[model samples]
Target: MGPFTFISRNSTRIIAGAALLGLVLPGLADALRPFLGYCVLTMLTVSMLRVDVASFFARVRRPLPAICAGLWLVVVFPLTLLCLAVLLGPPFALPLGLTIIFIFVAPPPIVSAPAFAMLMGLDGALVLAVTLIGTVVMPITAPTIASFFVAETMPISAVDLALRLALMISASFALAFLLRRLLGPGRVAAARPVLDTVSVVVAIIFALGAMDGVGARLLTDPGLTLGITVGSFAFALAQMALTYAVFRPFVGVDAVAMGYAAGNRNAGLVVAALGVTQIDDMVWLIFALSQLPIFFFPMILKPLGRRLVAAHSAVPNARSLP
Candidate 1:
């Protein structure tokens, strides 16, 4: 309990430290490699444990904003990227560009997006609600839209892909419900720090495990790997800024929360859904490199998030938020 509470209190340093560990110790990362799947499932379950069910359900009822956000992520943005690729043609580097664009169209936001938002002082319920809304719409929307662009590059049938998403998500949510019932909602609410600590521990393990070959890649292809790393940060930050800008007027302060959700998406979900034993190293590199922002952004943006959340709380007419 003491250690868990300490971890909860100092999660920012701990999480950033985890990223550093992954970069410095490739062997440790490889040892934990097999636990990546369990880490994800734990992240999803722990994320649900802290969410405000009432707020989640309210957003579920009035879901227009979530629907619009999902459309932007999976459909509109991908189409826009496709158009740009067509206009620019050869110099645009279609293969890499396609990989970049595929980030947005991948399943929902990360399972722990809500946890990240809450850690950064944003509204967790809003993020969770919007994310699940995206998930419900993903199976049909993702594969249909990706088919137009990805085609043979993905090499998976639409039906199997959808089923993979369903199974993983269903299992996580079911586990969440069972845990909640066993602990009782009141007890869980009272032990929030422990839950936060669980999220921190799992996230640390995840960051370490996901960086298996990234350090080696850095040694081998320093320039190219560095360039891709830069590109990954650009994609995450640019999408977050763009999403915040587009939705702020309509959703008010809640848009800030939406921006975090929009930018830090779950590209890994696409890999899991593809159901193949292996994929292209380049594609996998892009996906793995992408986790950097997702893991580190809460620490980086903590101050800005504090200001935004403070302003959101102060303004009465902020609209459509708890």
Candidate 2:
């Protein structure tokens, strides 16, 4: 098979491997460090390319529930994290590594939520709806949340960030449109594999850099490093559980998929939108650790998803039977 086709076919395996490989390849991290900004932008633009704007607006016509879900994700969820941080006091809220706090304040879920939702037999359309709304709401909400928690340390003020975010997101959409226009829609559509291959490569590069110093930090301060790592996993699962619980009655079967996006925030999107080129290793550690649930879930979720799918499949049959 051609390299692009191969990559597209095996992207999940490659993505999973990339996360593990990052732990061992700090050199790859160094090589990719300078280009981090561009890498972030490239990844964001690629995501924009996949967005079906027409379909999104069509979905928007009667999307009150999805809009609320998106609001909860980008606004309420981050505020919730901040409240928890306050209640828990200083021990849980490290100044440099506000890991859990960052989770919600960051952008929406990774661009693959719709695909992941489909893979698990969940509501891909709901996932897409929330994702689209979250992206639209992010520029305004991101800085609002970040300013409340990290104002002094932030590189830019909330207003500046809001402006930058607006420009960057707008430019990305413009870039995507320009590319499609230049290449033509059919040609662009035909290049899905190629675009996916590029995204995979960008993700691999990002994973490696993000994991830089993580090993040495573990060696130097096993307690802190391991603590954050474990806590990230725990909090991630808890977020998913809580989200699933809260939305179950209302959203039904889609709760699992919504929770899937809820727990895994796309920090990379925040990094890109915030225009932060260099992040501290402590911060990077959080970014790296946040990735575990996202990368590993697909492996473990299949059986659960299968069971859920089976249960729902049997429901209609049961109803139809006398």
Candidate 3:
């Protein structure tokens, strides 16, 4: 079996998807640039098709957890990173802060809810619900938050974001609905493997675009690149720790979901937003490279998550009491 086959069978395909993106697309640099937007459209389309909107939302039988997850994306994430960026302050500080805020404002990872549900052992259905809701909300939230650090570049207001979001969200929902309907219910089970394969292809193309977006800058400043990578990894670890502290009191699975979501910012969106300006683009190379941390975090965390699951399962009378 291919290494991808191994990853496909596991819950860490999100990382694998990113790695494939980084490695596979640079050769197609010329073609990849103009079409990065289409590459994004494909990923989003696949994500939408995979979602069962009615079924996903139905799982949110309660209001509080859903609300908390929303708050994480909209408020807590941005505010926390803004504080961190201010505290860090410089060559490393402003750019790193922009990376954090760019992603904070960007849409949640395309696969985050599902990946979090699987890896952290949360309710996949509920996670899916939250992800869908967050996505619809992102276009508005993203530009607004992006404006704080990047005022000059972000001339488009939240109203524009709302309009753009409506278009993209509608496109996602439409394509997904058609694809799923054509696949049919029984055949849908067989499609996961196929969809996973396609996701890898699209991911590589997306990564290539990301690489090209910053390739020139990366070639110029090795020190800045190194600093951003190290700093980003540190930030990721901090976010994960914060997530665990916040959500552990609620449930282990919930903690896992929040931890991954909080830690793994969508690098594609981060890169795109930073590309809004020439100066921002120059600094964004480091931020783009910084995303390597997410693609690696799973190796250590996955095994630990499994152990936590086993330990939780072993708790005497816990299940019965609940």
Candidate 4:
């Protein structure tokens, strides 16, 4: 097989290796930080290039599940985190709480989510539908929710952040459409492995950018850095478990897809919007550590997904039963 094919086939390892590189080479992350917006746009565009617009729209037309996923992701989940922050007022600093809220409120990781779902033998179409809606609505809902939680203290104004998000998302969609028009669906389909390779490479750039300053923070405050890293992993796993349980009763095997979306947020989007310089060190540390689960969870989740799919299939009229 060609290099692209090999890279695509080993995407999980590629992601893990890229993440390891980011942790070890903090300077590379700092170097790439300036171009994070372009990197994000490229990742989003490549992800969208392989989508079937017609099927995506058709799924949108059946909007119940998508809306449920959106509301849960953008609203309920953030609010739950906000409430927890409020209840644990002393332990959770205002800035750290807001940072946590920002991470949860952000849209699903559009670039790798569908690919991850497919890798696990789950419903990629369902993931695509939910992620698209969540991403498109992020500029509006994210800003509105963020304004309530963060208000004047936010590094960027709500309106400005929303505008940037809208522009980036729009530009990605437009570029992806242009590519699809030029390449045609047949070519796009045939080039899935290449696109996957491109997506993983873009993810590596993002990982590097996300890890900017993380190593320095680790050296400066080892205890705080370690605490936040562990906390981030716990939070991610808890979010996944809760979301899966809640949706399993209603959606069966698709619950795993929703859970993945809930757990793997696009914290990079928030990081890009706020800019690395604008964020506090603690907040940056948390955000950087949160990326761990997003990159590595696929390894743990793939076998679980297969088991869930098999279990669901064994049931009579599983969809109706749910």
Candidate 5:
């Protein structure tokens, strides 16, 4: 089997990603200190280019599950996490709580969803739909959700966020259409591999950029830093668990599809928002650390998702008997 197959089927990728983050984290000054936001913008742009807008909205005939997942990410999950942070977490954890909530409120990651769909054997179209929908609705939904926790620092302006989102959607739609019309359906087959490689390189650069000033902050206030690290991880785990729970009843193809769509999100968008709002740098650190959960979830959950897909695939001609 190939490396991705082996890594996806086991927890190796997750462990490796976490280990790399840990090992490099202490020495991030050399890697992430200078180019954080610029790197983030590079990855975000690549992800935007990868979107297949036509395919995303074409399958809207069966959009209930996708819409529900969007609602959860943009609404229910954020509120619940905020409530949990306020009620149960340490008082100082407020910033981390806000950071976690912010991630759920942000638009979907442009690259990860497609990668996730392939890994878990989900319908790429479905994942794309959720990604499109989430990004479209983020401007309106995100500010509304973020308002609850950040009324002071940012005070939540839905109108401003919505305008920004509209520009992204319009640009993405135009690009996807232009490419589709120019290259036709078959082009995606060839384009995907190149895009995948580009996505990874861009993601690494973006991630490094986000870490730019973090080493100093991490060194200055290790306690707060530790809280963010732990809080972000816990929140990521909770979101993943919640996603699985919501889709468990639909085991098989739908289950895998839902799991992939639900689990993967555009967390980097939230990181961008943190920058735009000029919130505390600690908040950005929390969100950056939260990316670990996104990277690792497929590794942690793909085996179960694959097993479900296999079991379903085994029920030969179950849905198509002549």
Candidate 6:
């Protein structure tokens, strides 16, 4: 096999390795920070180019479940977190709590999600549908949610936030359509491995950029940084668990897919939308550490995913879509 094939096959390791490198080499983060938005747009463009539009819309036709999942991801999840913050008070009303809310307010990380779903033999189509829906609605939902919970903490005006998100999503979809028109869907589908490799490489660049200033923050206040990092991971796991439990009754392995979507938010989008330089250090740190679980936990969860896939396959008339 060629080098590209090898990298594609070993994407999980590449992702984990890239994330570790980012954590240790804070300088790369600073150097790459300026290009973070470009990287995010590129990754989104490539992933969108590869989307199976027919499959995506077929899932969307079943509007009840798809809308529910989308609402859960973009609206319900963040509101729930806001309620938690309200009930907990004190520290929960602080920057850390706002960071937690920001994570959920962000859309599903579509960059690697569909690829991860395919890798684990889960419902890639459903994952993509939920991701696309969540992303498309982010412009409307994200700013509204942010204003409700973190307006004081946010650096940008609500209108600016909405405009940035809309621009990002629109630009990505436009580029994707142009690419698809030029390359044709068959040609694009044939290059799945290449797309996956490119997505992973861009993700590594993003990971490095997101990690900017994290090391200094750690050095400045090791205890607080460590606490936030741990909390980030815990929040990620909690999202997954809560999503799985809530959606299991509707779909089996598909619930797992939703769980993955719920847990792996596009923090890059939120950061890019907000202007990373304008955000609080604590917010950046939380987003940075959140990447650890998003990239690493897939490897840890692969076995369970495989089992879930196998079990779901055995069920009579089992379908990934509700």
Q: What is the TM-score of each predicted model, taking all chains together? A: 0.87, 0.88, 0.78, 0.93, 0.73, 0.92
Off by over 4 Å in 3: 1-7, 10-31, 52-58, 83-100, 104-106, 116-122, 147-149, 213-220, 270-279, 315-322
- Give one digit per residue, the lDDT tens place, for model 4 in 58-91: 7677778777987888777777777677678855
lDDT (tens digit, per residue) of candidate 3 on 1-322: 7655654665355545554455445556435655555666676787777665566656565556656776676566776666666677764256444544555435564454465446555456656655666666777677666666655444355556556656766786788888788888656656767776676677665555555544444457767766766877887778767876786666544565666666666655434433324325544455456556656666657776676657766765432101
Task: Give Cα-based local distance difference scores for all models.
Answer: 0.75, 0.72, 0.60, 0.79, 0.59, 0.80
Where model 4 places Cα greater than 4 Å from the true spot, the runs are: 319-322
What pairs collide in candidate 6?
none
lDDT of 6 by residue, 1-322 (tens): 9877888888888878877787689888889877888888898898899888898887878766667788998888788777788888888778567765765455665566877877777788888988888888889988888777777777787789999989998999999999899999898988887887888888888878878888888888899878977887888888888998898777766888888778788878878887767767666677788778888877887888888878877887654444
Task: Tell me the tens digit of each residue's lDDT in model 1 across 205-311.
Answer: 87787777789999999998889888888988898889888888788777888888887887766665653236566766777788888777877887898798788
State the lDDT at 304 in candidate 1.
90
Model 2, TM vs. native: 0.88
TM-score ranking from best candidate downward: 4, 6, 2, 1, 3, 5
lDDT of 1: 0.75
Candidate 5 per-residue lDDT over residues 1-322, each given as its tens digit: 6553444344335444543464356565345434544444554454556656676666576677677766766677667667777777666246655555666545553446665666766567766666667777777777776666655555336556556556655665576567667776677655655655555555555555555445566678888877876776675555556675666554335545655554456666654544534645656566556566566666666687678678877875433101
Name the candidate that leads on lDDT: 6
Candidate 1 wrong stretches, greater than 4 Å: 91-96, 275-277, 309-322
Q: lDDT per residue, candidate 2, 229-268, as tens digits?
A: 7887787778778887777666566677778778767777
RMSD in Å for all candidates: 2.8, 3.7, 4.2, 2.0, 5.4, 2.1
Cα RMSD, model 2 = 3.7
Give the candidates in order of lDDT, highest first. Answer: 6, 4, 1, 2, 3, 5
Clashes of each: 0, 0, 2, 0, 7, 0
lDDT of 5: 0.59
lDDT of 5 at 92: 26
